[model samples]
Structure formats: structure tokens, C-alpha cells
Target: MEEKQMDLVSLLLRPELPNVQKELPTARYRVKRLSELLDTDVVFTLKGLPYGKVQKLRESMSDDVSVQILLQGCVEPNLKDPVLKEHYGGATPAETVKAMLLPGEIEDLSRAVERLCGYRKLTIEEVKNA
Candidate 1:
């Protein structure tokens, strides 16, 4: 009798298979206007927010969602830093973000963070399952 080939489903179900998960991704964005204001490059490092946090932000529907996202996702120019907060004359991280960034800049950074978190509009073909 010949042995049968194991299918993908069977292979995946094998208990011995090591669980391999990739780390969350990060990206850097340069705010040109800010850089110009500072007379140097003002680049910010941002990481993807976890699904739970993103879901909570969505459900809250707060006006400061963008600021909240920046506070959570920005790894560089640390928005939560005490010095930055002082410089911005903001008492909280969210206030610092609002004071430091223009409305359009906040929106742009929020969109960038969302992209890193795997949010994007599906193409028509993709929506059709092509």
C-alpha cells in the first residue's frame, strides 16, 4: 500500500508546527513644514497600533481620535515626553498633539498610522474577490 500525501489543512493542523508570528511593523514620516520650522528634519517614527486599541478608538468616535492615535503610535519625537508637552504648553499628551500639529498634519499622520495598522480601501477587483 502506498502512503497518501498530506494536504495543506492536515499540515497546518500538526501540533508540532511552531507558531510563527511577525512583529508589528513600523514606519517613519517626515513633516516638512515642521522641519522647516525647526531648521532641520523633523522625522517621526510610528508603529502600528494593536487591533483592540484601534477598535476602541473607532468605537469612541471622539473628536480627538487623531491625537489619540498619534500619542499611541508615535515612537519618535515622543509626543508624551514632558519637555514636548511643556514646549507645546499642553497639560496632556492629546493636547500636545493638537498644539504641535496642524489639523491637516494630524489627519495625515492618523492616515499613515492606519495604513501601518493594515487599514486600506479595497480595490474594486479585490472587493469582487478577484
Candidate 2:
């Protein structure tokens, strides 16, 4: 995984020391609930295809793609019902995942590391000169 993504995963797994216990449970619960919500069934319509053919088409897609299409299909239904909209947050499951990872949710740990290292390196060079 990319460094940024890894950092995000680390942050999700374990936030800063003081908040770790509280944040961990909330994060785990949110991830589990979102996953279950995303796993619900979706019907697909294949052009000019009979039932069996459509089933085959659905089977051909990767799990990720299938879930994406399923969530997209739910948009209209969700829009029509307030409860569904509230549950879905006015966005698809994929979108919900993206929202959770936005800057608001996790610290910029990678950048923080880089800045600390840079400062340390500079201080070392200054000490050597002195």
C-alpha cells in the first residue's frame, strides 16, 4: 500500500496514545457497521439478457465492482426515503469510506514524520558545525 494509505490504516488501528482505547472501539464499530451495510444485495439489469445471462454477468464482476454498482443502484431508492438517506448519508457506501478517511478523520502522520526528521537532520548538521 502507499505510505499515505498505510499511515491512515495505522491511525485507524491505533490513534494517539491517550485516545487509543476510546477511538479504537468507535473506529472498529464504524468499520464493522459500514461493512455490513455495504454487503446488502443489489439487483442488476443486463441489456437484452435473460435471467440466467444476467446472473452470469453479475458473477463476472470483481467483488469491489459489484459492491460499487450495488451501492450506486441504491441511490434512487435512498433519495426517495428519508430514513434510507439518513442511513446512507446522502452518498454511496464507497463514498462513505472516502469520507471516513478525509483529513478530518486522521492526522497527517506521514507529513508530521517528515517534518520531524527534517528538523532533526538540520539540528544534527548545526551541532556538527558548532
Candidate 3:
């Protein structure tokens, strides 16, 4: 009986692509798993991270400030990164407002989060930054 149930669960969990309406001729971004979005085998988890850091990210996600907060929380030696260190040195939330222009592959960060949010299905949302 357990084996039968396991088989049924596996079938139900398979990934399926949804019918997405493309706004333009160009393809639209689709939510993929975090592992897939990074194009590497690494699996990032938020386990054991500080709640304050995560909350700060959620609050400021609409802005680029969340990126550094995220990196500081999960990615080790985050402040050591020269690029981040130079731009964000003594960085405050207000300072981040003007830093990291052309955040190369900003899409990746957004998409990855979207994908993580939609682990069971591909759910995508686009927000224009003014």
C-alpha cells in the first residue's frame, strides 16, 4: 500500500509548464527552481538565517537594497566582495537607493525568488521599477 501511494505522489509532483501569454514576440520569463535559475548545482536555503535579515529583504525587495541584505545573510564573505564593498561601504538603506546601477542580471535575482515562491508551479509576476 505504501509503495502504491509513493508512486502516486511522484506523478503528482512532476513539473508542468503553464500556458503563459507573451506580451511581445520575445519570450517571457518563466519561474524555475532556484537550482535551475542559477544554472549551477548549488542549492541555497534560508535555514538558520537571522529573521531580521530576512524580514529586511522582504520589506525592501522592491529595491536593490535587498540584494546586499540577502547576500550578507546567506552568501559568506559578502562584505568582502570588492564591488559591493566599494559601492556599499558604510552603506545605509538610503545609500543603496543610488548604488549598484545596472545590477547585471537583476532578472536572475527576481526570477529566482519568484521560482522559489512557486515551488509547486510556475507562477510569474512582473513589476516595473520607476
Best by lDDT: 1
Best-fitting candidate, scored by TM-score? 1
**lDDT score of residue 30 within candidate 3:** 28
For residues 1-130, what per-residue lDDT tens digits would candidate 3 score against the true structure?
Answer: 9998999888777766322222111113222442366785443332123445445666767666435543543332233456654676535533442253225333454334333333325456787979
Worst 10 residues of 3 by lDDT: 18-27
Question: What is every candidate's alpha-carbon RMSD to the true fold?
Answer: 5.3, 18.9, 14.1
List the lowest-lDDT window of 10 residues for candidate 1: 121-130
Question: What is the Cα-based lDDT of residue 80 in candidate 1?
Answer: 89
Cα deviation of 20 in candidate 1 (Å)? 9.7
Candidate number with the higher TM-score (1 or 3): 1
Reference-based lDDT, residue 85, model 1? 91
Give the alpha carbon lDDT tens digit for every residue of 81-100 in model 2: 54554565746555453343
> On a 0 to 1 TM-score scale, where does candidate 2 land against the true structure?
0.18
What is the Cα-based TM-score of model 1? 0.77
Tell me the tens digit of each residue's lDDT in model 1 across 6-67. Answer: 57667788987744224567899999899999999999999888888899998886688888
Per-model TM-score, in order, reads 0.77, 0.18, 0.29
Ranking by TM-score: 1, 3, 2
Please give the lDDT score at residue 41 for candidate 1.
90
